[model samples]
Target chain A: MSNIQAYLRPDSLEGALALLAEHQERARPLAGGTSLIFSHPPRVEVLVDLAGAGLDHVEHAETGGVDIGSMTSCSHLATALRGRQLDKSALTDALATLYTPVLRNHITVGGNCVMVYGWSHLPVTMWALDARFMVVSHKAKPRDVDADTFFERHPLRWLGAGELLTQITVKSPAEGSGSAFLKFGRDKSDEGIASVAVSLRLQDEKVASARLVVGSTRPMPQKLDDVAALVVGKRPSKEVFAEAGEAAAKAVVASDNYLGSADYRRHIVASLVRDALAKATQRAGGAA
Target chain B: MKIRLQINGNTRELETTPTRTLLDVLRDAGYYGVKRGCEEGTCGSCVVLMDGEPHMACLIFAPAAVGKAITTIEDPDGDRPHAILRALADAGAVQCGYCIPGMALSAKALLDATPDPNEEEIRGAMEGHLCRCTGYVKQVEAIKRAAELMREEASHE
Candidate 1:
């Protein structure tokens, strides 16, 4: 006799979302079930199946960006993102470097976003692109929220109780914009000790816009606005790159096992920031 | 929970739990071809094709796989057959049989999707599946050869 009391395969997104709302207390939605099933929840009564809900897609929208379905697996997204979704390539390539082919095939893009504790590059890369998620609830309609605020958890707040994230949308970066993502780890499979994603919009070889995000250092991966500000309106020379790195290193904070002392993490921040900046600049056609 | 899944073209119903790893389940089925190198999902020994994608059976809960099809080395040529074994053998990539199944399956899955994988794509696809014997040189060659073989075969059609 097993305790997995029920399994429901909803045929549509709304049906699955409705089931999620109805059974939020006892049931956990399983997309690929790569992470949820591992929790060994105190109560294992139900597995709400989202696989059949027609959400596993990566479609090009008419407006030029991509509409990524919630059920899209990391490996699948990585493949689709290769030459087509270059703006989000940092996230996709990072996904390619995850543990092994096995886990990537099973891990859902939505589940990866929900597991955005810092070891992941998906959330940070998406955040750098200003991507937004469409979350639905027991309420009337689906709503959109920015990546930064969607995952921020307060001290005692258990948020997202009734919401189910549906789709992720990322607009295409301008032709002059470029991005790069890098992750450092103690071992190949060890969760990233430090990760950064840099997005830059260049104007005549000068950084008209820039965003630098760091993960695996704090409770959440966030943009170091100061670092971006340091590079904005400046040509991406070695000096500018070094300054951006230093500014990013200064922003490293303490949280969740970042593999070393705050000072060491800062050093990594500086090094990877420089590396990411140089690469992104080159991707934007700036001379390295 | 007793569920039926097609393991390498063979169907059987087995009692399992969400905590029961695919490695443990496959071991019971006598498919020793699927290695159990790392239980933490780092090693590719526990790799298997679940509905056309290579996956770590260790990370997947068994009951959640109600009607899915699983393919081990036993199902060679079932999903992306010739990409790894044939092309890799043509390229002399088999150093130790230990990592071959996982490597082969990984290569098979990648070449199935993109038959023209470059060096970086090959490295990205085979990131954590370690082959201590060949130093990855031969494995890279094997993937390339496998892609060529796949394309050659596809062109025949």
Candidate 2:
């Protein structure tokens, strides 16, 4: 039996935030708790649950973006997004393909970003979309932190305190921008050996820019800025797109090499990057 | 870890560890319909509806689910009455009968949400629940028949 003495379920954000502000050292907001409860340090005294707080909706903002509440479940995303005007269906598909129906229902979007599991698909997918999260703590008000920059800065680590991740906002894709996510796993439907998330925008069918993020390949998903610049303003035919995929694989190889041989990761990267780019291009094309 | 929870429409308080799973709680409370075939989440024999959504009971922490509503196969009414119990018997989907309860309940979750679920929806909802005896072909057929029957009932209403 856990020695935990008191468990509090707070209903209002202000009340929860006030409690967190007072007990910043010992307080941690619990969502889904798929990983937090099982893999936490032994010093936890108070478990503040956010399940009853009613922060669980996917609201399309009036300003051309979406503010997905931190507690949104992956299974709900899979079921509701079947015919929605989501800019990234491959990312949606990758989420739907998570392990099994049961786990997907329990995992929350906010926890996916905070824990940032190596096996998680959302981090890889959102990385390419230039997603940002709303980080809120009682000590400080709320602030919007860019997803990539926040990881690099390690703001959460610097503070040495738990910050509640309140929301994730992804801007509506531009006219030419298209995004896709893919993973090639050893098990037929299990976690991936390696995965890639790609986003592209073109001007006159010539690649204007691309954002490529590869997953389970390093400490975290690697951003392929150099590889993306290589194909900008170039017409991406089947051959050209294959070259771009090879460039992405090569760039990943140059960065932190995977546990697998450099050649094996490159081979898998080559295929996934190619498929993701092709799918994104088709999505961007839009039969116009 | 003495935890109080509402299980199967009744409040039963039990002592368990933070690590002790909801599967342990239900079984100790005599709700053995929540089978423990595979302690790991891979086997869906422990599938139950937490707050009306089908979830794997083995993976849930007893403390985490303290206040949430949990429904086992014993939760009465709906298609579980006519569709699952009736269809499983008619189509021979209950071989050893170990997997029938979960398969039936998971189908109840699906068919209740969608009165006329297609083959793909039923198959997707039944991903980890396995029946080594039925070969699953007849089980899928049975679930499809259940959906059709539910649809007919919906249409008549």
Indicate which candidate wins on DockQ: 2
Interface RMSD, in order shown? 3.4, 2.8
In order, what lDDT does every prediction score?
Answer: 0.75, 0.75
Query: Interface RMSD, candidate 2?
Result: 2.8
- Assess the local accuracy of residue A30 in candidate 2 as a C-alpha lDDT between 0 and 100: 76
Q: TM-scores for chain B, in order?
A: 0.90, 0.89
DockQ of each: 0.45, 0.46
Q: List the residue pairs that clash in candidate 2.
A: none
What candidate 1 gets wrong by more than 4 Å, as runs, is: A1-5, A85-89, A154-158, A186-190, A255-258, B78-96, B111-124, B132-157
TM-score of each: 0.85, 0.89
Off by over 4 Å in 2: A1-5, A22-25, A62-64, A79-82, A153-159, A253-262, A286-288, B1-4, B14-19, B78-82, B153-157
